[model samples]
Target: MAVDLFTPLTLLLNACLAAVVARRVLGVPVGWPRTILVGLFVTFSIGSAVTSFAEMAGIVTGGRFTVSLSAAFILIGLVTAWVFVLGLVVLVVLEVLAPTGTLPSPLDLLTGWKARRRRARRYAQIMKIAVRHGLGGYLRGRRRTDPYHGTAKIARSLRAALNEGGVTFVKLGQMLSTRRDLIPAEFADQLAALQTRAEPEPWQDIKAAAEKAVGRPLDEVFAEVDPEPLAAASVAQVHAARLLDGAEVVLKVQRPRARTQVTADVEIILRLARRLERGTPWGRSLCVFELAKGFAAALDEELDYTVEQDNLRSVAATIEGIAVPEIHEELSSGTLLVMTRLPGTPVGAAGPLLAGFTAERRERIAHRLLGEVLRQLVRTGIFHADLHPGNVLVGEDGELGLLDFGSVGRLDTPTRSALGMLLLAIDGDDAIAATDALIELLDRPEGLAERELERRIGHLMARYRTGFGRGGPSGMFAELFRLVTAYGFAVPPQIAAAFRALAGLDGTLALISPDIDVVAAAREQGRALMREAVEPGAVRAWLEERLAGYLPIIQRLPRRLNHIVEDLEQGRLSINVRPLAHDGDRHFLNGLVQQIVIAVLAAAATLGAIMLITADVGPMITPDIRLLAVAGGALLLVGFVLALRSLALVFKPR
Candidate 1:
């Protein structure tokens, strides 16, 4: 009735033989080096196992049952560790060797080893460049004499260096620039200077690439092709042109030989990623290899003009209050994209609009953009993940033009609902609901206990609220991102990418208009829509539907609560607490923290408040000891009231 060890041994043998067969067929390295290491490890494991079995059997026959059992346990432990180490070695060796489709010879291993060494040297060089650039930037700022001017100059230099370093560095710089909490605010501000800008490619090269893409000369398809480029970027450049029908159009042309260059860069990055994963724990936690691969794929899609054109149209169709330039379908190709020309001032120049338009108009525009973005994220579960000032243009007539949809996100319905609840709960200051919503939205959707999920979410929510209270929008978002990235929150890659894009928008908006209250605008729009959604009748109807769906769980709440209490008492629950430092006066800090905590608690009181609150919490009070918590909370409440009133006023007029 007992299982035999020989059966498991046969499976192990088969696995090893399968690997050998695969390596031979695939033409990978099968030299003495790996053979020796594997042979030694296998011998060690087998010898240990055999000796333990012999000892155990001998002790059993000798009538020493306790000694035999103890020896058996020790043997099992040693063998388990040995097998684990060998398995990891085998997997890595296979990963490297399998790619080449052949067993590696000694020369191949030596070549790979040497290449790795050279790569390490190259990384050192890159690190040196980064340090020099950083320090040089600091010195340049100091040299300017005027602090502001000096910082600006250094920022400009850093931006140039980042762009020059190539695609990966540019993307990293862009991401880091938006994370004010992760880095010093000064550095984040400076890095924000690096937008999606590159020197335009020459006209001759553009024409040749276009011809190559379309499989004909530029003259064959168009009456006039502009030689001078309208705009340029690292991947593709844009040119203005005229069609036979007198249509003013812009042609997005892929950079000459960019595909090959990108491929080479990606290869380098992949190799570097593998090295980092092998050598550094930080790299492993970051999943550098996977991140690099994802970035490469995204950049590849961006290089295909046809794909970008499709994304542009898709996003425009999904989201209201935004428009994408019409793509000229007939004239489009993989590398050549022609779109209807749009005349608009860059959103970066919104300052000019402030001088001309009334404050209400400005607020309206902000509301439209923010609301539409949130709606797209909720309703269609899709959003532009690379929204920055340069990609958003303000027309002379005030129409918003959303451009460059190469990076976009699509959330599943469940995920979208959780995100909505997260937004609503945060605004309502309902920490418990926010925590639950975030856990469902962010972590592994299934196979998680409700209590465990809630505990972690609460901890994270508390950390974020604390940060938001102390450091405001820039701080809160930055810390949230760092937390998610560091802790393996299991956020899908697209969501992570979306976070980067939102951060970019935050930085750009701040630069354009410091007075623009982003959260307030978002709140005002969400509240007006949600107020109608959760009126007395609406609330009753919604509750009925949810209660119907969750009746089974609702009925068992008492039992669940008992289990939760037990777990908490036993200290079996884990929390995701993020620690933030206090920078303001002690009394003021305490008051602000208490107020945010109260807001969080109040928001949790009812789903209606969460869905309908229209207040900006970012700037309730300046960091000062004189600011009373009660007065600050009152001001926030008043702001919420006025915002709701304003919405009512707008609705009445419409």
Candidate 2:
């Protein structure tokens, strides 16, 4: 049977199919604007294409051929998108060279390979350690989730493997500890103790790195330089010293092999992240690729001591009754830093000193420490990210000081306010309010099931409100993160840092004052902020700021009104309207006009068709069929199709 391929049904169907094909091309915009443009282009293009092809092929061509062609087009489009995005991201990530900071030249390719060969020796040892620790299965994609419920043991094994992997993996494990939402609770807990401390770098390597950084000899710069390190960590080591001016100070020196070691490990980890993400459902759900990228970036930032120098100088008394150490600017360099050594033991370890204090006194110190953390969060917007006990010091008088300002979390005003509201809401057990605040604090989780999340939060509140059985601050946050993650949301890195800070402080409080309520302390701090915000002086300042914003408008209002009055009096009052220039106005008007015109044309044609077919007054081309009746039937089909198309366009997604 001969088929007319240019029929409205065939043309419309072809255009719609082509549009679906075009959407998979990916360069097309993601939403309505893209959909509209693509649909319009396909509609115009397919009409002309079908007409040209049908004229050449004649009416013997049928609808089945068009359907087959459209299906093939869609298949090819999807395949093209897959290849393009994969090829693009792989090329970008492969730019990183093993054991080197930048791309190696063609001449250095063999030399680079040789260096990497040496690195592979260390890498093989690390892998051996992983295999020995029973992490080989996980790394090899032979194991994913622990179906036997031995996550705790697996977590411990992973932590041990990382600890043995040396400085880089220890840091990676520490970074992973914050992602409680992604990893199991047992894993987060086990990895939480993954310390970055390593054996001290040899005195020669430390001294040489320090001297080179400062552009001077040690004897010329200091009265005495200690050979023994006071503390040692993966990236840097600290040594107690005395300056040329009889001042006691601390020297932080970067390890000589730190950069190269970290670079090689990061490359390996990234490759592992890719493999895991590709092989396991859990890896994709956890977004390990993105997590590794963020970890690498942070490690990159911490490699330079100058960044820490700026951080230490910038960590001021943003909270009242706190003080910061004075850094020696002349002695500071990207590879070395000199600062006054504070007099105190770590707050968490000063158990003997704190034992003498009354319960009220310990409570006060706890409140102050947590208050300082919150103050940094909402007020200054910059906070010490690693808020472990070792970073906090307690003097005999019970005053506290913060140390090691290398990693910090910064929040903008909106995020800070939203986070504060979230903390307060959750503490108060207002699930709806907490849900609202969470929507504001988090980046993704859009179009979230708000009522369901609130219900889940309500259940969480019921469970945790019964006392400290549900773990302390860390437990509460871990549960909260897991809940959000179940809804397929990724926790932002800054928010993760904030949660870890609070968790570390909770651990600190437990060491000193186990009876203290961490959530209550946070609530108290939030309440204090609220009180200060509403104080008379604060209210006056706020009102002044608000009024200042309106001052320009107020000044212009009178003149504008007077001009309007004069124009009215002089008979020059006129309103210039450009309603169509506005998007909402134009869209509504255009759609309304289009629909009305379509309806009129369709009704007139349909009525005319009925009249012509019923009149039976045209010349008969055949014995059984009249040309007039055939024309009327065609007009009727066209009018009905036009009406249906107009309806479809009206309902199409905007």
Candidate 3:
């Protein structure tokens, strides 16, 4: 068995060496991390191969075993020297063929093209080798006999496969599901069914991590700890426990070697991303290095118990009614997090949990939940990034219990401003401003054409408007994505994940009570937001002063216009308005200008139409634009009616 394993290991090492040569020859981005990993793999492979050869020699020599360690070292040195010499010779020959400081000869181009053609032809051969080695397990159906499998079975299979592939693949699957633009409906659908249900580390590993964190044995610290975990996730798992003082608590333990695995895997991924940067335009545009760094930071924070503890406290302080379990600081660390255990049933079964409550009471609870969400997102920069039904629970007293504070989002001042503006634009149904906010929030390319972006945003709004009545929640969400995709606007992975969490909440509410009004819940949340802005004596006074500041800007508008007129009279400012010079006939010139004007007008109209389509009603909508649109429409109607009467009088019999 050892010899069998060593043969494959040796072959793999040789293959890696081959790849190193290819990378140098092609000038591809095979970075230090890949080279290091390959080096380790090759070293191990060579060692294993040598051990197997020694064993075989021993068997052939009738158990004499005369091969010394020094002899093995000499053989390895000779092999290395031969490989190096061959590589140097190849390099020298290529250098001689090309001559220094000169362009490639015609023959070189022809040969290079031929080489590329050969590579393309050999691509299939490479794949075949992978298949031969069982790397095609992904494509091969494990249960091919289950042809009549239902959706649930298929979902299970997909989830199983994803879990087996590990964290990076699982995360990639989750990200792809949100990308309705790139992925097919079926794959996306399958991915949506996947949830983080990874197996927790053994109790011993948890205890070891806890000991490392608190600087004591589990028995010394905890009076009792349930051997079984309450929840298992990709990064960490939770278990109910009690402190030595008899305080009931829960322990969140990070998996052993998770950081090491993540570091190794992410390095590989980053190296691959760098390689892609040279191969694909989109890869370069995406700034994969920055993205990888951001992702690594986010994931590392998730593994940090200290971060989660702070997040929970921040959330509890910002959001009213909802409570997060208090963290036991003495027992907490980067790996082990101990918190007061709150009793509650999962929010999914809220009906049964809150069976004693009336419909009105339930509505109030819903409003509170919605209010908490809005406050966390709008009032506080730090918001609960995960808010799925599973993450929330309803206590016996009807208090909301928020769990899993590992993942949270932070918005900078600019993102906060953009978010506020986005909400305002949405409420007023101003598609152009909404689009601008979106562009700002997404950090869209500086070179992105403003007019085109506005048009796409309008289109998104249009989809929202048209789809709401006909398609309902899912349809509306899908429509919103269609517009995003159509415009080539990519939502960052975190933002996309946040949206998915919201969608899950929506789906949960739908399942719980069909009669519940999502939009109404949203509106109540909005009112709570406006109320929060005017909270105490100081806040209210500050708001009043800010309103006064705005009033002066509005009041000074006429004076600014007067100044402009005065400046023009004094020749301080010259008005220069001239139509483009037309060399063609009068009619043709008029028609060309008309077309240009018409196009501009059409663009403006399209923008308006888009806003009207995508605007959200109720509390989520800002009153500013809605009122403006209403007032504008009334004036336009009255003006049209007056014009018609005047025209009728002018064309009268007299």
Best of the candidates, lDDT: 2
lDDT tens string, model 3, 1-654?
999999878766775775475345323233333333444444455555655654653421454535455544544443443343333334333334532233544566777886546544444443354355343332332323322235455445555555555675466456556555444445566786667678778888877877888897889988999989998877678899988899999888888877766665555546545654555455555565566566667666776778888888877777677778888887788888889998887776666666677766666666667666766666676677666678787777767778888777666656666766666666556888888888887777545677876776676555554234443554455555665655667776555554555555665555334556776566456545655654697487887888988997889999999999999899898767655555556656765565565445545554554554355542211212243443333333333333322322222221
lDDT of 2 by residue, 1-654 (tens): 236645766656654654454334322223333343445455555444545544453321454333345433443343333333333222223322221134445566756888878778876887799899987776677776742278878888998998888888988998888888778888888888888878888899899999998898998989998899989988899999999889999998889889988988998888789877888767776677888998888888888877887777667635466555678889887778898988888876898998888888888888888888888887677888887888888788878888888887888878887887876776788999888888788855667787898999989887877554567878888988989988767777888888888888877877667778776677778877756666899889988999999999999999999999999999999998875788998888888897898888889889988987887677754344455765676676556645654554454435
Give the whole-model CA lDDT for all candidates, comma-separated: 0.62, 0.75, 0.61
For candidate 3, report its TM-score. Answer: 0.56
Which model is ahead, 1 or 2, in terms of TM-score? 2
Tell me each candidate's TM-score.
Answer: 0.58, 0.67, 0.56
In angstroms, how far off is 296's CA in candidate 1?
1.7
- The C-alpha RMSD of each candidate to the native structure, in angstroms, is 24.9, 13.9, 27.2
User: Candidate 1: what lDDT?
Assistant: 0.62
Candidate 1: where is the Cα deviation over 4 Å? 1-162, 175-196, 444-472, 483-488, 507-514, 529-654
Clashes of each: 13, 0, 6
Give the per-residue Cα lDDT of candidate 1 at 537.
94
